[model samples]
Target: MRTHNQRDAPGLRDSPSEVNGKGTSGPEPNKRRGIRGKIINALSPISVGKAKIKHKKKNEEREESKPITVDQIRELIHEKKLFEAGQHLLMMEKASYAEQSKEGKGAARSEIEAAYGLLKQEALRVIKTSVRMAPVNPELLQNTVRAIAEQVKEDKTAALEKANVLSVRPRLWKEAWKEMIQESVTERMQVPPFDGVEGLSATAHSFLHMGKAMKDDLITVVQHIKPHYPNDFRVCCVYAECYYQCFSSQLEGIAQFELGSGDNALLLTWVQNIYPNEIKKHRVLEKELEEANLGTLLPLKQIKHLEETYLINELESLKRCLARCLQMEVTRWTQGREPEKLDGHFHSELSIDAIQAVYGGQKRAKDITPDLGKQIAPLLLVELLTFLQSYKKELERFLKDNKQRQHFEATVIANINNCLSFRTHTEENTMPGQNAVKHQISVVLHEIQNAGFEVLLQGLFQELQALFKKFTQKTWLSCSSIMNEIIGCASNHMATLRTLKEPFRQAIVEKIHLHLVREHIARLVKKKVSLRSAEQQGQLSQVIQTNAATLHAFCTENGSNARWLEPVLPRLAEIIRLQHTDAIMVEVGGLASQYPDISKKHLAAILYFKGNLSTSETRGILSVLDIHLSATLPPTSLFSDIKLS
Candidate 1:
């Protein structure tokens, strides 16, 4: 029935007689003599030492009775009570260190150290379990990995080894890498005036550094993750960038060492290695863009802008790389030569075969065959054409709807602006050896004029040719209607292409006129005509007149060069005149035959007065018919005998 404190420390309960007079529990002072007590206290140090030893032993026993467990440490870790867990582990290690300092306590220290190690192991297991629970969370993975890294940082070799193993897990590694990239971008964004190559390079360097630090780790992670996101453009771009950093570093070093040394074999090797996949990526991006459906809840303008922006960035990156390659070649070729002498010296070095090789031979060998360094120009032209062609059908479809057309036009304008801005940026940022690169870009632009016009003409010609062929076989009314439709379609296309430049506008109009309208008219003239009755003849006459008049009006309204239609107009007019004259003669004959008493004078007057007949020609016809004319009756009454009325 002892109190808890007394039971815990029985010496205090049994020492009442030895307590101090002030009621503190302690050994009682001896009453033999005051001087004797002082001498005894001063002489005995062993008793005080024994009391301290006893107190330390009791504290140790109390600690051992309620020892910390690995499971408790793990629970704290699971609760994310990391600071508390660390404190507990630190306390345990400190206790072990203290115990090792004690005499005859080597085995106790070993036991404490083993417990601490087990606790650390449990903490790590808990972290792994948490990560597995939320593997896809980038922030969580990043934080957990960071914590693990910090925890093992004192043993850097072991920490890096563990990090390597952890980063190889596909889900964990991707989230960690993406988080790193996003953090880098955020950091770069914090700086001011961030809008050019410097900003771009800063951001790119983050990825480059990470790739350098974790080369195999990054590659392993990417290879494992790519299958799940095949068409993810961002992932594709990042992957390309990693490859670029890995491969370009070696190439860059080689170029720097070989600069102005007249050795381009190294640069060419780099080009051959890098260009194939880069060009292949372009084709892949083009295919993806072509297959993308713009029909969604998202605004068409935004969708188009994003798609175009992605493509522009990719193309610009390729262009920049190509420019760098060209620059290196220029520098290499111009070594030991005066700046003036370097002019046109590197032209022949730029070959389509090299470029075609870069595209993995996807382009026809014939198409890419170089023309005195013009091969790169046309190769790039083909790329631009492919981009435009992919969107052509969709654009046409867009034009069919008013709202879509407005959105499409806006997108086109935005794309053009972006192109201009890119060109200006390239020009402004020209490096030392980029003159040749600029020349190549200019050549590509020039080639686009011709190539784009050809594509435009080819498309319009095919369409109009079919329409013209259809017009030639149909009835005149149907033919006229088809012609009008063709004209309208051509007009719309011309208007659209006019956004490009004068060459495109002029070429489209000229081609449509020459191939469709002019051909249709020429073929119409060669058609056979067979009139079986007067009514049929009249109908034929009317159809011819209406078709001719319609064609004339269309040409006039459309600003067509009228000289081309000169040969066909007069023939059509003459046919109408002759049909009218024939009708007039037939009517005159019928009237004369009905009135048997009709006089020759009346007949001559009637014939001369007919609307379609010329006066002199009418008189000649009267003489040929053996009819006589007399001055006889009054001029106004001369036709009185021609009718009974």
Candidate 2:
């Protein structure tokens, strides 16, 4: 039989029966003999050749298992095969781990680890080089960062430190910051609404915490990144939003109070303090944005849209606050509560504090330092008009039922007179309440003119006619008092009354003229004057002259009504001169002679009146006047004897 070492080698082995029968003792002797045989075989040339072949194969396998070369990694990176490059790095790490685990291979393991480290650094260098060549390739930087992060997970602290440094790059920092904001926004949206007061308080606290956290993050990012991209719109927006969120949280907490109750004062105070600061902050940001030339990074249209949105939100919130305050004050006034002190003055019914607050807002609006003021001015004006309108209705209803209407009317007239006398306040520091009151009066006058001044004038004209119908000293005095009040009010607000001046003057003139005409006709009917008598004609002419002189005196005394009436005084005089057909014909002849260019319509207007002459008689008078007037004209003229009929 072959020796055990030779038997075990080259597929040779001991027989099964001999192996079983030998058991423990037999195996010990066989093991010693096999060791000697194995030594002899290892020294033999054939065994040595086999061992060399095996060792060579093992070396080849080890070489095959080695990490990917720097050249291969560079090729992958160059081809944009970032995933493959990452995989190669992972494999290198695993190979390093394997080498470290092997027994008695400490030196080789250390060498492999060093090679891996160098390859990793080289891979990162290649990635960074690629990025430098094409710095806009965000994918390259992202992949490289992710690979390094993964490889260095065991040393997370170092990895994080490295990441923080890497984020200093503008593109990298912007992307990271944007992602952070987006995540916060998404998380905020997903937060469920709370139910009760306690729940709401909890929610508010949570929002406050979140706002603080975000603000801190924003501060950190901006401190690090602003130097590189000072004009970056997104970064600037983040900074703005951070402040906005903090303020909003505080506002939201304040908003939890019932605004319609005793908390209104607190709410108003908070709003008054916050709104101006918010506007100032916005203005400063706007200036900085301009200085940074941020318009290039952010399109003008988008920036404008964002700014408008922000301003609109702020204005809307402010408007709500103001409206709530006004409503609360109105409620208080309606309930007969003592009025709040406004500018050291207590008003009984007027919500003077609310008015001052609104006026303050208007002054801010007029300043135009904040561009939102332009948009807000109109809204505030609407609110003021609405407030005035409601007050006017209340006053009308009060006067309708109250026994002291005369006293109220006298007080209002006196106030108006006082206001009119002072063209402007002598003191530079006019009280805001006083200014607001003046502005309120002005707006009220303007609105009255716009809404229904004509209607009011028409009603007054009718009232004057009714008073003239029952001509007595008491009635005339009453009419005069009404006229004085109306005229005084109009004169006090002349700028606002300018538009209705002509209509007002016309109404007055027509009313006075109608009175004069009715009186003249009544006198004639009373005298029963027969135009056939020269004496009666003289008497009628005298009546006409007296009435005309009275009208002239009335118009002259009332200068406001004289503007339109003076131009028509001659026509009135001519009308008054004609009491019968012959007199009308003669008067028309005199008018035509006085005005050589007078037309037939002019003669008819001068002669015509409602019950003065029959149609045939009037036609005959016009025909006779035309003939008489035309007879004086030159033959070449168009009017010379042109068919007087």
Candidate 3:
């Protein structure tokens, strides 16, 4: 043992020189034992203390590595550290899945649901703002969608694992978000100063505006907000569904109400026409909207009711309109007002108005009342036929007293001109009742046309009556100026009638030709000129031939299109000029074949003009014409209209 100062000196206590000295021997046993014991005593407390500190650090590390608690999750969420909160949520779900305690699992499930619910609430608020086209921070929308995606993952995992704990938690948040989409649409759509669709045209116009505005809002969704959503959202389809439901509800309101024809038509127009057109008008929207597969705006049963109701009502309304137009026309006729002409042809607004009424309704009908044009056409035509018959009877009644009226001929001509408009439109048609109506209508128009011609011809013949009586007399030469004078009077009448349209213009020319031929033949049948000499017969034949030539020239120049009747007068003159009865019989056969309506009296007149023939000869000549008289007379017959003495 050394002194205290020497002993306390750090270098002297464990001197490296003394320990490393080669001559140094081991310390005595007692001394070494004492030093060892002292060393063990000093290090014992330090070893124990260090072992406790190592165990305590391990406990702290374990505490740091464990997942966050529910409280801590809430704090992170409140701090807007959603990423860390989401990690905590997943860990909580996994731990809840592993937990065997029902009570503890239930508590964890509740907290997880509560946390997800808060997230969904925030997400929905952003979605609503975005769907409504309100400006929002992009990050909020991104975060919202990310949360939903995670929830979707949880939903899928729960489904795959059949997770009993996750079952207790609210799930299918994606589906819930879809429901929110519908709710958003409903909320946006209900806002309105709604229009009343109680009237006819007003209802259609109002609905069109509504559909257009809705489409515009949806397009705004596609442009501004849909990008923030995932493709699985199918935002377009959901938007379309909500819009369809809203529109369908409004239409149901219309279907439940009692409607008139016009009102029903307007409703159907919106349902079938304007609505479909509006949804498809935007190409971008069309593809998405069709995918939604929204059915018609109204039920089929309701649509059928509206259609039938509209049809029946429209029929009655058009009938009333037609009756009114007819009455107005009759009133005009009674007042002696001439029906108007267009482009030198008679034209009536009644036909236009009649067709327009049906077509206008058909145009508005869209798909409702299929083939409305075909269905409604017959009604108008039948009504018109009835009115025309009544008109013709009224004209016939007026015609008897027409001579006293100053404007009778002009008014009749105007009415005749107007008939063309009706006839041209009312021809062989495919509409119901078209054939029967056309037949009756044609008869009535024909009678009116004939009466009109008689009126026109009556005036023309008056000037030429004295000249016609001079024909077939002894002074009447082969080329008499009387025929020229008659033709001249006819020419003057033709000039006055030139304003008539084609077919009518040619018709009048043909009528004059037939009348002249009939009158010329009538003179020969008078039996005044008995040509006992062949020379007199020859002279009369020459005169007849020359007059026939002159009449034909005048007719063809004035646009007479009657080609078959051209040879009648020339052939008759040939029979007179022929001397042999055999040749004349053959000639008479040809003439009879040409004019099937040639009668026995007409043959006798021709035989009497060539008076040298014996009675047997006359009998023989008439026998050749017998076969033609019993045959059917054509619609256009010349000799049947002639009077035989």
Candidate 4:
């Protein structure tokens, strides 16, 4: 019987010799030769002729076969036997063509179309079946992708030299990490429970292993990647964290090596620039440092760049100032509990000797000797002040030369006396009371007044005032208590101004008031203006010129009023009302021309004072600024309608 395999060769059983049952019968020689020649012609065409003949033959075979059943096609496809399915379609087409040939060409073509339609439909069914049978293997895919990446990396190294690898290093690192993570997941996820992992259940053990493995890989990636991807702040920070956790052992090896003979100071400076937030903590990372683990984690190269190039000398100087922060062990052991308490011994101020001592203490047995006491002393002192502020409640009251001390006291008393006669606080003085509560202001005004203290009371207030002034001039390690003291001293001094001589009293009072105005300007500008700036100095001069009028008014309200203050009133008035008018107008004009980034509350404050509004009304005007005029303003003038006093 003929089978599907028999279809490969036609008429084998029906040959003349086979039908006669003659196994060795010879055909007529010429006839056999003609048949062989015809066969050779057909075979030669099969080797070289148009592909259409094979297609026609296939179509004929399909026409003779039954139409493919959807289920049978699905089984072949699901088993991934697509070639067998195609053969079955061809057989069916052959059967159809052979049966329909007697009909017209149109009928034969229609039969061929039917067979083709069945084939295409069955192909789609097989596709769906195969897709459903495919296994979900993300791990396998991930590993395969990783293998491709590794191959690419090696190829790149071969094609492009290893020395120029930085160009592709970041991408390579990212790929490597991605691959490592995938591999870790696969290993931990696919692996079954084994001996020595008995404590954890299957699910728990899998997760634990995966987590630990991932952590290690992440840390490794970060350690290698952090120095390269600096602009990516997120990655750098993540790497920093991972370095601490995953590759801690590797980091410990790094720590054993000294930062070496490079410029540590410069390196520190760079660390501050790039990793400013890290330095903002004031403590260094344990792994990146040697000695007492106090140095910064920044590399030497970065630090040198900062010290050599960055603008803003103040910030750089500020960093230098911070480095001198007192080490607690030496200070507490040698100088006693406080700097003030160490009166008999040489003070632990920021001198060259002091810095050396602190540095030496950290080294246990090593000596750190620095020369040049004059310069070193001041630097060390500044450092100590910053450091002390970080740790303690108050700074030591350094005793200046007696003459200088007297001068300092005069400056304080004169300013305070001036503010008392000149400036007025419509609100209750809350600043001094607050400082007293904070323990920053040591002696209260009431206590001094009760004791009937005159010179001593003035001295204490002046001392507080001088301290506040000094604090403002430099960068302190901390400002909480220091700020409270300055605010309190100013409040108390303003309350006491009229009690002092008129000349000194009014001048001091006006200077204090001008400083407050300047403070507002500073905040608005988002930049520092030294007290010596021409604009600020000019403002102060005008405030002094205006104080005579303010002082007279205060004296008139408070007592039989000093006539001395009255004479200077016009001069003061002219200074405030006219000379500064142009400058004030300029600021206002600028604000009018361009919307300032400053808070409207501050803008409205300057406006309120400019209008000479009453204190109660000034706050109300500011409230309007905070609520209504802040973010949006109509093009119409804000000040055009409001009248100035």
Model 1, 370-399: lDDT tens digits are: 221233333444443343333333333333
lDDT string for model 3 (424-455, tens) is 77763436446877788889888888887887
After superposition, the stretches of candidate 3 with alpha carbons farther than 4 Å from their true spots are 1-115, 129-131, 134-146, 187-191, 194-202, 217-232, 276-282, 327-341, 345-348, 361-370, 390-411, 427-434, 462-466, 628-635
Error of 3 at 564 (Å): 1.9
Candidate 3 C-alpha error for residue 390, in Å: 4.6
User: Candidate 3's C-alpha lDDT?
Assistant: 0.71
Q: Which ten contiguous residues of candidate 1 have the minimum total lDDT?
A: 338-347
Pairwise TM-score winner, candidates 1 and 3: 3
Cα RMSD of all models vs. native, in order, equals 26.3, 23.6, 11.7, 29.2
The model with the greater TM-score, 1 or 4, is 1
Candidate 1 vs candidate 3, lDDT winner: 3
Give residue 593's lDDT in candidate 4 (0 to 100): 33
Give me the candidate number with maximum lDDT: 3
* Highest TM-score scorer: 3
The residue-by-residue lDDT of candidate 4 on 494-555, one tens digit each, is 55444444444444454443333233233222212234233444453454344334434433
Model 2 agreement with the true structure over 1-645: per-residue lDDT tens digits: 889887668434454544456544333323223566577545676766999999999999999877567567657756656556656755654455456546765554454445444545544453324312223455554555455444444344434566433221121323443444444443432335555545335445444344444344434334433333324235546544534455554555555544332233223322332233333234434443333232121234543443344445445555665567546533543343333333332223233344555556655544423454455555555555555565455444443453233333322222122221122221232333445654665666444333333333344445544533443323321334443443343334333222223444344344444434333233222322224444433443454454445555654454434333332335435444555667667665664554454455544543433245567886876675456454343212222212222
Off by over 4 Å in 4: 1-32, 39-645
Could you tell me the TM-score of candidate 1? 0.22
**lDDT accuracy of residue 104 in candidate 1:** 68
| lDDT winner between candidates 2 and 3 | 3
